[model samples]
Target chain A: MTSHPHPAPTEAGALPGSLLIRNLRKEYRAGQPVLKDISLAVEGRGITAIIGPSGTGKSTLIRCINRLVDPTSGEIWFGGSDLARLRGRSLRMARRRIGMVFQEYNLVERLSVIENVLCGRLGYVPAWRAFLRRFPDSDVERAFALLDAVGLGADFATRRADQLSGGQRQRVGIARAVMQDPALVLADEPTSSLDPKTSVEIMELMAALSAGGGTPIVINIHNVDLARRFAQRVIGMSRGEVVFDGPPDALEDRHLTDIYGGEGWLS
Target chain B: MSEAALSGPSRRWVRFTPVERGARALVYVLTAVAVIWSLRTIEIIPEFLYDAPEQTADLFVRMWPFDWAFYPKAVHAALIETLHTATLGTLLALVLAIPFSFLAARNFTRSGPLNWIAQFVFVSSRSVNSLIWALLFVAIFGPGPLAGTLAIAFRSIGFVGKLFGEALEEAQQGPIEALTAAGAPRSMILVKGYWPQVEPAFWSVALLRWDINIRESAVLGLVGAGGIGVALDAALNNLYWDQVGLILAVIFAVVIATEFVTSFIRSRIL
Candidate 1:
């Protein structure tokens, strides 16, 4: 598939979001913890890459923001509410402004590409209408535009997500997330399954999304080089704690050795 | 080539361990003993087998001389009754099973005691034969078409609920989670995420059971629960072999018709 590289999202006004996490903690077992007393704030605008070795707390931290994996103890302040304490309708409303992308693409395999993209509006639309596929004309048109903006042609709209290549599926995933008109986008290992070239393409697409709008992205990634190439700010984690936090240029071999604990893999 | 491979079939290279061989021998011996014991207990005799063909031939001879005229009114009404019993029973069972299956499905219910109760209902319904269910319903409801319809519905809950429950459990979890993250309501999750995935399977199970119910309900009249089987029972009691043959023929035709309709619908829709 050729890259069309259409223009950025311009229809929906960009409402950049701010997030502040205070003393976030998650313990799966009684004593052992996956994330420990971590605090970080993402102001707005630009991609914030979280690079760490496998089994670290990078994924946990990202998931906690959306309350997918509830934090053991913390305050998640986003859009004038504590995301940790919200329940039921309030939680859902808070989540509508926050969009998330997964490692697996996670599009409903049986649904067509257009329907999957329109799923982003499920929070706003009434249940009956959504179930009946009676999405408003404006929503449908915007979904098509989002698909087009992601370099997928109009023909791809009717195709099933499973029929596409890995790269194409990721494109749909991006389209779905942006379709939410989100303030914050959380991505968990979005490119770990793709080839090197496709990985770069995914990163480029995400970067353009962050740049065009003021939406901030916290991507948990393992590819350090890709993170450096794409991320404006990089936060490195080791043993469930952030060991280094700085701009990409400020990060060095010493910090890599500290975060990953290796000298041989750097060269 | 090795000597073993060249001398024998390739399968010779694979051998059962001594424990496996011993278990196999023990199983064979036990099965042989059990079969012999059961045959003796049931009083199997060579004399019955010798007379079987003769008796069948006598009955077959008596069933000749087509009673086609008897089927015009009496047999036709009974056949329609049987169809009604089956169709209404299936609709009732399908409606009842939808909620029970949710309780039984691991993903939907998630409650240990409720799941156990749902499983219990399914098992009990399935364990009783349709004839036995008709007998029970007749005792409670006083031997009418009402009894027959209720019997069919109760008997089918197990079949429909168990299949539909398994369908719910087999649905893909990824889309479910995606819907949850999008903050869709619980009902919406079911409507959009789960229903589409399981719609074809639900229809297939219901159609199969409807075809079977047609056959089962045709005989419920033996217990005076109503339907064409009542006509069948009356014929058999008076030793009216020709009338019996007519009823049997009508039942055979109806069953085949129902099978054709269900399969055609299944093929077209699914």
Candidate 2:
């Protein structure tokens, strides 16, 4: 497994820590914690894969950063502001800067692919424009470009989302994410629903997008090999806590055992 | 070993108490009595059976003998007015229901008190029948198509709002989550995620309501609210069965035709 090296530091106006989660804790019910005290800083660019066993809080942690599931206690410092305290318009403004891809494509199934891709601009575009399906020219161009980059051609734009295959839908999903011109991209088990070959392709597209656009990516993945293959840094999680955080080369069998527990499954 | 095991169970059965036996007998007796009672109560008596056939046959005979002459006048304007009233009412209802339905949806309105208020408004609007609403409107607006239109529109809001709200609730949570995560405002999320999913169901419901309103509008005219049913009612009162027959025939044909058209439209949409 090989990893992409981190991008060189740039002087452009970039958020210092694309995401800074400090002492994050979440509990769905009292005394039953989904995410324990977690502290991590995601770099400004490149993919950082979060690998964890099933039932671990990998999904919960990613969701918390986006505040899809609000944190019980924590400060998520993005750019210069703490997202946990933000509400209403302020929260939406922060969210607009972040893009998310999901395990399920999550495209509005009845909507055309172009419309689904254009949904990324819903935050920036006026409600009337969204309701009318009248996306601005620039957003359309960017969506088309992103679609082309993801290997979908012009004709697929008018097709209903449900008509597409899994890989095709995920490509649209990625396009929608990038359409946001997001500062940070969060993918939660994006490729888990795809076949191995398609998973690799999806991961490659995500990696390239992360590196090319210099968008910081925090991905929750179940496959260790895929994580090591694409990510610059691997954060191993078990029972809602980070067990190991280092470069993929430094991640060894012991760390895997510790993260997953027991030797029988490792083979 | 097998004989001894079986014998022990048989001996236990023999030890069964008189109370168990009495309970079993009671169950059988009660079931028998209940069955006999129901049969006696439900059995159609000779008098009812003899009375219904003659009445049904007389009605059929009286309705027949053909009403060809009245068809021309009935089809010329009355049918058209019914369709027009229905179309106006349904369209108006659809426009009014959209905002109210969004407010009424529990998922969208998280505040319990607000949801209760919305629900109260929706339930109250729907509680009154269209005919009753038409009567009330006629009292306010006077005898005209306007009252009929308002009545149909008001009644339709209850139905469309409740159904559309439910459809909105059942919309895929995935798109909503994605929109929220992307920081889209509540209004944006509704347009992008919620409306798209519910649009088809909304349209279908509206179309169905339109068809029903057409039928209702026909009857509203009998109450002085403008439609063909007034003429039909007068014809019936004057014992002009031939004209009544003609009006009934026109209504039946119109309804069937509208249903076919609506079904075709719904199929294309789906």
Candidate 3:
């Protein structure tokens, strides 16, 4: 398991809250690696944006954190516990502390806005209560508050998710993620599907929420400008390897060209 | 360029060989000959051409002079009984189908052998017609609405279970993944992720089964299982054509009413 070589670090930083990845390797097929021996540390409460081209295993990397896509071999140490080794009840408990936002919104289309938002608390609540739509009063209040924070008012709660526009649905998605009251939030291309203005707004909202909650966020973004604007630290990936990791001021054109492989799209 | 070069080559028309054309013609001729011969052999002469319109008109006239008082006593009790049978059977089937559907759905149960067993049970239950099931139940349980109800219920389980399983399998994988990641038990995922997605489909299928069961229950009584079918059988046996006409009219009315009610319920749910 420990035979694979660790890839060279693109940058060095002290990541908070102690999420240490040591020699993480994932391969879908035998000897055909999707993720090579990737080692990194995520520390403290701040946004870390992972920027990479498509099919470079950015989404796969984030999903592996939550075990949505199980890693072939890795050690994810968070808060003195190895998340990879946990299973069943213990795994769920760990996941409740981790929130995730998707690019497509992935809201339950048939369920009402409030119900979909309430799903974030599914990890905390009893199964019977969640099944019956009998969410706790505090959770309900918090859900409504989160909705308001995301710019959707109380009236929109009763409307089905399918009835909402893309922006509104994504707002609900973000609200649901926040509803988990997670210690860590992972956003995989959160603004990829949104327009320019909406993307900025969403990024701002996520940055503000993470800041206010003191939660560490790891966001996978394709937009370098948005990432530079929002993220405290930007990690660049190419060919499943991190090529650059630093502050916006420290990043130059050469590094961008190296990461994305061309100067044509940079303009 | 020359006109011939611009126009390109003239394609050869591929025509069928003489033998092939003859064979095609022979097939048509044979089909026509067989159809005509079979029709004649079955004595399918159109007797309507020789029918007396006056006699049909007289029969209709007789049916119209209905014992209006008979409608209140005869239809009311039988209609209620039919409704009861249908409701009971549907409820029972819904109860029995839950576990069976879970077993049958490949998404729910990955075990090939278990899924096959569930499918076998569903197939066996559905393979026998409702009427035959009713007859068998009548023999076992003795003649009553119980036999008819059981028959309808048993058949409905197979129908509803198969449909429910399909609906269950097609539910969104996203939420299920989310729940699993949250460290939720399999049961929790089922309750949270599976139930919400499949509920409307389940209700829609159950209502459809109810509609079908109502009609089946009505006819099951013909085999002594108890309902309007028993009355229909009696009317036909006695050669009371007036009563038969009356019963048919009532059955038609009941069917239409049930259809309307079920449609209304279905619209509300979906």
Specify the highest-DockQ model's number: 2
Ranking by TM-score, best first? 1, 2, 3
Best by TM-score: 1
TM-score of 1: 0.88
lDDT of each residue in B109-194, candidate 2, tens digit only: 77788767767767877999888999999999998788988998998888888888888878889989988887788888887888
The TM-scores, chain A only, for the candidates as listed are 0.93, 0.94, 0.92
Candidate 2 lDDT over residue span A1-267, tens digit each: 023132233336756537778889999999999889899988788899999898899999999888898999877888667777778898889888889999998998988998889889988998888877787999899888888999999999999999999999999999998888889999999999999999999999998998788888999998899999999999999999999999999999999999999989877
Docking class of 3: acceptable
Off by over 4 Å in 1: A1-16, B1-24
Q: Which digits, one per residue and each the tens of the lDDT, describe model 1 over residues B1-270?
A: 898877785454447988999999999999999999998899867898889999999887888875888988688888888889998999999999889998999997889999999999999999999999999999999987889999999999999999999999999887777777777777877887888788889999999999999999999999988999999999999999989988887888888888899989999998
Question: What is candidate 3's local distance difference test score?
Answer: 0.83
How does each model score on TM-score? 0.88, 0.87, 0.85
Which digits, one per residue and each the tens of the lDDT, describe model 1 over residues A1-267? 123232222234333487777888999886788988898877667899999889988988988888888999877878766787788999888888888888888888878999989988888899888978999999999999999999999999999887999999989988988888889999999999899999999999999999987689989899999999999999999998989999999999999998999799878
Show model 2 residue runs off by greater than 4 Å: A1-17, B1-52, B66-68, B71-75
For model 3, residues B155-268, the per-residue Cα lDDT tens digits are: 888899999999998988876776565555677778767887999999999888988888888888789888888877886788666776787888888789889998999888
Docking quality band of candidate 2, CAPRI definitions: medium
Model 2 TM-score on a 0 to 1 scale: 0.87
What would the C-alpha RMSD of candidate 1 be, to one decimal place? 7.3
lDDT over C-alpha atoms for residue B47 of model 1:
96
